[model samples]
Target: MVTHINLKRCIGCQFCVQVCPRGCFEYDFEINKVKLVNPILCLKCRACELNCEGDAIRIEKPIFQNFFAQLI
Candidate 1:
């Protein structure tokens, strides 16, 4: 899964940072925005997107089978 953080709309709520079960989001003190810290840990769960009040995060759904094939 690929997650993108839109810094513009983010208000430093840290809600996304708190809700991600895999610890995917991190609070960046300098930018005051939540960032994707470990994308590979993401389970493609929409919890972040649903909890983000500012709608600042987006997740890209990957065609996993196709992606896996590229490694060969």
Candidate 2:
């Protein structure tokens, strides 16, 4: 599973935090943004990325990408 945060596009709307069933996201009041507090806890359901209007989240890269990524 892949989970990333793009602060440039993220509006800190908390959509990811609210939609994540695994409690993988958290809000950082200091930065006025959301953070991936527990990526391993993600179920790779893509709910966070799909619900993100800002398109800042990406989960589960393609199978080929995952295979090669492990080699590196």
Candidate 3:
């Protein structure tokens, strides 16, 4: 799941908005920044975090999920 987005570091580039497969992010023209609109829909794929040039996105997986992922 996505846990945080530091607006101060976000460059309004919309990379996360474009890369999110679940449409969890949106570009807010009023603020010229990206917003996490549907965090519940996040798939924890890290696509948003990896694509964010500003490194403003953070995703946290459950401990069990991390352990299972390591096994795979």
What's model 1's lDDT at 16?
Answer: 87
Tell me the tens digit of each residue's lDDT in model 2 across 1-72.
578888888988899989989999999999988988887677788988899988888775655555554344
User: Which residue pairs in model 2 clash with each other?
Assistant: 2-60
Stretches of model 3 off by over 4 angstroms after superposition: 61-72
Number of the candidate with higher lDDT, 1 or 3: 1
| Candidate 3 per-residue C-alpha lDDT over 1-72 given as tens digits, one digit per residue, 9 for 90 to 100 | 335899999999898877788898889999899988887777778878888889998887555534453234
Assess every candidate by TM-score. Answer: 0.80, 0.79, 0.78
**Best by the lDDT measure:** 2
Using TM-score as the measure, the top candidate is 1
Estimate, for each residue in 1-72, the C-alpha lDDT of model 1 and write its tens digit. 578888999999988888899998889899888878888778878898888989988887667646663244
Model 2 spans with C-alpha error above 4 angstroms: 62-72
- For model 2 the TM-score comes to 0.79
Which pairs clash in model 3? none
